[model samples]
Each structure stands twice: as C-alpha cells, then as structure tokens.
Target: MKKITTPLKEKDIRALKAGEEVLLKGVIYTARDQAHKRLCDLIKKRRQLPFALKNQIIYYCGPTPAPPGKIIGSCGPTTSSRMDKFTIPLLKNGLKGMIGKGKRSAEIISAIKKYKAIYFLAPAGAGAYLSKFVKKKELISWPELGTEAIFRLEVEDFPLIVGIDIKGRSIYDKR
Candidate 1:
C-alpha cells in the first residue's frame, strides 16, 4: 500500500497504478449530483467557482448530518458514473483526482487520460466506518441542498484504491 497526501501532485498521481491500495491524507472536497450540476453551470457561464480546482481532489459523497459530539456523519463514496457529464469539464479546469465508487464511462476515461488525472474508489456501504477518517468538516456551499451541500473536509489516512489511473487503465475493465 502507498501512503499519499493531497492535494496530489502530478507525480503522485502518475506513480499510482490501477488496483493499488492507497491511504490518503489532507483536505478533500465533498460534492454530489446537485453540487456537481451547479459547478458545471458556473463553468459554462465562465464564472468563478467557490474554490479553486488546481491540484485538488473531490470525493463524491453527501454525508448525513453529524450527531452531537461527532466531527462528521456517515461518509462514503457515491456512484461516480452519475457525475460523468460534469467530470471532463472539472478535469479541464485542473481537478487532479476523484474518490468515488463504480465504473466510469468511456468519455470520462478519455478525459482522465486527456487531463492526466486519476479516479479512486472507496468501499461501498462503508459509510459509517469511513466517517472515522474525516477529521474536520465545514460547509462550503449550497446549504439548502442539505446532504448534497458542498463541503471542505480534512481527512487522515482515508482508504481507497486506484480505480482508474491517468494512463486510462481501469480496475473495472472487464478484461
């Protein structure tokens, strides 16, 4: 297993291979369907995003509300393929990595190669267990969207696997 820290550099991303286990530390952003749609809309209008995308990692999750005395609630990766339409644009804007579950579309795989980015997979149905990795969480935008709100999270040793590497190698490939 490789231990990595984010915001991941190009070298860090390139060194990773599909199916390799990784333990990631540092800040990652959380965004789900609604947040992705809004981000894409902003990009279409050529407007500023709430935060910069350069060398950043986005985790596709909408965590449940935290209970009292907890830093965050159940947090796990959501289906990544659902955000396929918006992903390429984010990649073009310098987003370097993503953490989510499931296979990606051909277009997204192409974009991953084009942008020299990587896709990571967190275990499915392990939300409660994964929440322990989140050290801190702060709402960044779209509070009205509730669970779908964008958040800035500080995570430590968050477990994942390289589902797709920058070379377009994918763990989910049938071959």
Candidate 2:
C-alpha cells in the first residue's frame, strides 16, 4: 500500500490508478452539502476561507458527536454523490482532491478530468473503525450548520482507495 496526503498535487493524485490501497496523512477537511455551499459562496465573494484549499483533501463526512475524551465520533465517509454540485466549483477554485463513499455524477467526473483531480473513498459502514485514525479535530467554520460544519482533521494512516482518477475513471462505475 502507498501513503498519500492532501491537498493533493496534480502529479501525485494523477499517478494513482484505480484498485490501489492507500494510507493518508496530514490535515484533511470534513464537509457536507451545507458546508460546501457556504464555501462556494465564500469563493464567489472572494472572501477568505477558514482553511486553505490548495493541495488539500476534502472529506465528505458528517461525523457523530464524540464521547468525552475522544477526538471524533464515528467518522466515516458520507455519500459522495450529494456533493456533486458543490465539487466542480471547488475544484475550479483550486480544490485538488476529495474523499468520501459511493458514486458521483457524470458532471463531477468531467470536472475531475478538467482539473486533473482525484477522488478517494473510505470504507462504508466503517465509521467507528475510521475514527481511530483521526488524531485531532478542529471546527473551522459554520458551526451553526451542525454536523455540516467545516472541520479540519489531522489524520494518520487513514485507510482509503482511489475511487476516481483524472481520466474520468471511477471504481464504482459498473462495467
């Protein structure tokens, strides 16, 4: 297995083919629909974002509340398709990669090709297992959005797979 980090540079993610196991490290952001829409709004207004998007990875997850003495609560990838509308704009604004579960839309695939970006998927139904990898968590913005709030998570050896590539390839695509 290879070790990968984000915001993913073009060369690194482009080099990742489908059917590969990877362990991820570094700071990754967590967001869902509301957070994504907010981010797009911020970008459109040319306002500063809570975190840097360049060379960073955005994980689509809405984790459960952590119990006392825990970094996070059942942190797993959410359904990726829901974020399809927000993704293209982020990618256009220098967002390099994404992490989540399930399939995405054809428009997202086309954007991936246009931007030379990558999409990774963590295991489904494995939130409890994945939470162990998050070493720390910081809520960056939109706390009022509840679980959809943007968060910065520092992860170590977070397990994942290359679900989509720059060539508009996706592992979830039925052959």
Candidate 3:
C-alpha cells in the first residue's frame, strides 16, 4: 500500500491515481450530511468556515459514541452522494481530498478534476475495524448535530482506495 500523510500538498494529491490502495496517516476531519450543509451555508453567506479547507481531507462519517477505554467507536464511511450538493463549493475552497464510500455523481467527479482533488473509499460495513485507526478524536463544530457533528481526528494507517483521482478517473467505472 502507498503510505500518505494528511494535509496533503498539491503535488501529493496529483500523484494519486484511481484504484490505488493507500494507508493514510495524520489528521483528518469528519463530517456527514448535516455538517456539510452547515458548512455550505457558511460558504454561501461568505462567512468564515470553522476550519481551513486548503490541503485537507474530509471523511464522511458519523462515528458512534466511544465505548469505555476507546478513543472512538464504529467509524466508517457514509454514502458520499448525499453530500454532493456541498462538494463543489468545498473543493473550490481548496479542499483536496474526500473519504467516503460508493459512487459519486458526474458533477462531483467533474468538480474533483477541476479542483485537482481526489476521492477515497474506506471499506463499507467495517466501522468497528476502522475505529482502531483513530488514535484521537475531538469534536470540532456543530455540537447540536450529535454524531453528525464535525470532528478533528488523528489517525494512523487508515486504509482506503482511491475511488476517484484528480484526472476524473473513478474506480466505479466498469472495466
């Protein structure tokens, strides 16, 4: 697996290709549908975002409450399409990567290319297993959204596959 670090540089993002396996290490942020909507609203209003987007990766997950003695609980990718409406704006704001599962829309794919971004897919139904990678977690914004609240996470060797590359190539494409 190709090992990569978070807060990816543009050159690092450009090096990725669809279908490549990667082990991501470093800090990543979490946000699901509700959080995404809030972020988009902030952008539309020309208000500052809670976090900077440049060179960042947003993981589409709403982790369950941690069990006793654990850093986090059952963290896994959510269906990415649900957040498509907010994606282009985020990309334009300098977001470099996204982590989620399943196919994305044509508009999203186009935006990814236009913005020179990449999309990654974590294993589906492997939340319990995936949580093991999260070394630390902190609520970052939108506490009212509960599990859907945005969070800052520190992860080590979080496995994923490049679902879509900056070139607009997608793993979901039938061979």
Candidate lDDT (C-alpha), each: 0.94, 0.88, 0.94
For every model shown, the clashing-pair count is 0, 2, 0
Give the per-residue Cα lDDT of candidate 3 at 160. Answer: 94
List the candidate 1 regions with Cα displacement exceeding 4 Å: none
TM-score of 3: 0.98
TM-score, candidate 1, is: 0.98
TM-score each candidate: 0.98, 0.95, 0.98
Task: Name every residue pair that clashes in candidate 1.
Answer: none
- Tell me, what's the RMSD of every candidate? 0.8, 1.2, 0.8
- For residues 1-175, what per-residue lDDT tens digits would candidate 1 score against the true structure? 7899988899998999999999999999999899999999999999999889999999999898999999999998999999998898899999999999999999899899999999999999899999999999999888999999989999999999999998999997857
The weakest ten consecutive residues by lDDT in model 2 span 5-14
Worst 10 residues of 1 by lDDT: 166-175
lDDT of each residue in 18-85, candidate 3, tens digit only: 99999999999999999999999999999999999999999999999999999999999999999998
Q: Which stretches of candidate 3 lie over 4 Å from their true place?
A: none
